[model samples]
Target chain A: MLSLDHARTILDVVLKTGTEKGFKPLAAVVLDARGAMKAFAAQDGTSLKRGEIARGKADGALAMGLGSRAIAKMAAERPAFVAAATHAVGGSLVPVPGGVLILQGGEVVGAVGVSGDLSDNDEICAVAGIEAAGLKADTGA
Target chain B: MLSLDHARTILDVVLKTGTEKGFKPLAAVVLDARGAMKAFAAQDGTSLKRGEIARGKADGALAMGLGSRAIAKMAAERPAFVAAATHAVGGSLVPVPGGVLILQGGEVVGAVGVSGDLSDNDEICAVAGIEAAGLKADTGA
Candidate 1:
């Protein structure tokens, strides 16, 4: 089980990295192995919508057992399928580039999602945050 | 405005307090003033349903600008109105005792909800968590 401290570490690192990089204010979410939220934060200037977007990306990654970047590619290839899936799930799944799975000892432990910046930048922050937490970022399915 | 750090702090305190009290594993959700989820967690043994219930309770409290305990009383008094209201909101409102508003400087900033135990016990945990975060609980209308 991922501890709350570890989740907070991921969130803090993500926000700090975004600040250091001079990216736009961001929102980040950390979810445990069961796809339940463990921690979350939205920088002061982030829009209220950032929280939901970040959570959607993270939940999508966990549900698919793949990084959100991969899901984005799939969505691009089959828009109809992705749309149907999102609707079926009550709009929880978002095909985006900011979600990365957290892996420890070669096992999936949780996920981190960042939003409010460009999707690529958001993904980079999530990867950096996971690495800072001494965990691997599973960006590839 | 409630920051993500504050939400995480509240969630952490609630879980810790529950553990200290030897209560059942719980799921908790924290929502910002706009009713957007800021943080959430389901303890190791908590059922998935706990998360939804917790969120429902919090959403209900926020929607009514009152505590879940008061909403529960209202529901008990007027079942028809409560049912219609819940249905109108797509079932987001739960008239239960686990939701408590978070007040800072005498203003409602957010709310917290806990589930996975008796409703009373869940409310106690939520109140404890809010108080630990240096906020007051508004359980009364």
Candidate 2:
């Protein structure tokens, strides 16, 4: 089970790293299997729009059972997938970064999403969040 | 100025209340100055579709400078306003009770929007959120 405490730890660690690296990031969210929030955080300077972006990424990962990067690649190969998602979710399935699926003992458990920084930075923070939550990041296919 | 801390506090209190009261809720959002998100949360067991409803309520409140309840009334009275909003921000402004404007020291700093519960229940959560954030809950004109 994805614990809220774990989500909070991931958020804290990611935000701390962003601060240390001087990144002006906005919001981060972690969601459990039920598609509900386990943890969520927004930095002081982050904007509201970032909230939507972060959620979109997280939802994509949760829905597709893969990281958002893979989803993006799939979107490229299957544009209809993205189009259908846009219609089905009312423009929530943005093909962006800051989303990662959480794995536990080789099983998918949850997802973490970050926004407010560059895509690379966001991905780094998301990985950091997963690490802080005491989980290993599956960076390889 | 609205702070992410306040937004998080509102969501925490409101969601806690929802769980205690046995209300089904899906999404919640807090908006700061310039109508951006300070924090957002989607609770467990909520449909991913509820996110749009949550953000739409907050956007409606911010756009009209009133609680979503008032916007609901206005929408009933002047349907044009609803159409205008729909055209304005990609139909992101949904006039409903799930939204509450945050008033700090007699000024509007932000708004809160909730979804997945009954409209009345959503309103109640918004009120609780605003109060929890140390802001006044303006439910009416």
Candidate 3:
């Protein structure tokens, strides 16, 4: 089980890491493997839609059973396929980086997603927070 | 301003209120006026889709500028329109009673949504939590 404590830690560290790195205000979401929101928080000044984008990134990863980085590549290579998958997943898929799977002993227990800055920067912060929380981040590299 | 503090209070109280009232495990979402999730929490046993339902209720309220209660009425009276509206809002609107607007001095600052038990019961807990936070709950009655 991906305990809520882990989710909270991920959210806290995601924000802290983003702030320390001077990234833009970020919105973070943590989802258990079942795709339920374990925890979510958005910085005070995040755009209203950033939270949805952040969630989409995470949800997309879970929907395809791949890190959103992989989804990003698939999106670039197969736009039509990605579009169909997004529709199939209830429109919660945002093909992009910054969405990483949380793996424990090679099993995905959950995922973390962050959005606010450039996609690569967002992915970096997400990885930092996941590693800080003592979990392996699978960015699909 | 519907600060994060207030959002946390609402989520906390909503869960507390539901448990005290002997309701089922609950999921709650507090969204700022711009439709950003300020805070969200779901009890450990909640169904995987509860968070989405909670968010849909609150988002529906904001999408129509009316409490989910009023939207419910409209939904019943105008199914096609509501269906189109739901699609228009990016499939985020759930027309139900558990979605209430958080008002301060007659201005809508945010919304609180709860789900677990019956719809009316969910609305009660949401209203209780909103009022407990020293805000107003507009059910659009």
Candidate 1 vs candidate 3: the lDDT winner is 3
For model 2, residues B76-111, the per-residue Cα lDDT tens digits are 999996888778867788887877888999999988
lDDT by residue (tens digit), candidate 3, A1-141: 787668777877888888898999998899999988988888878887899999999999888889999999999999999999999889999899999999999999988888999999889988887888899999866
Question: Which stretch of 10 consecutive residues in model 3 chain A shows the poorest summed lDDT?
Answer: A3-12
TM per model?
Answer: 0.88, 0.76, 0.82
Residue range B35-108, candidate 3, lDDT tens digits: 87998877778897998898899999988999999999999999999999999989999898999999999889
Tens digit per residue, CA lDDT, model 2, A17-123: 88888888658888787666666677876654777788888888777777888777777899997779767866666566667888899888888888888877888
Q: Worst lDDT window (10 residues) for model 2 chain B?
A: B39-48
Candidate 2 vs 3: which has more DockQ: 3
Q: Deviation in angstroms for B38 in model 2? A: 1.6
Positional deviation of residue B10's Cα in model 2 after best superposition, in angstroms: 1.0
Candidate achieving the largest TM-score: 1
- CAPRI-wise, candidate 2 is acceptable
Best by lDDT: 3
Q: Write the per-residue lDDT of candidate 1 for residues A1-141, one digit (tens) a residue.
A: 677668878888999999999999998989889877776777766776888899899988888898999999999999999899888777888798998999999888998888988999999899988988888998644
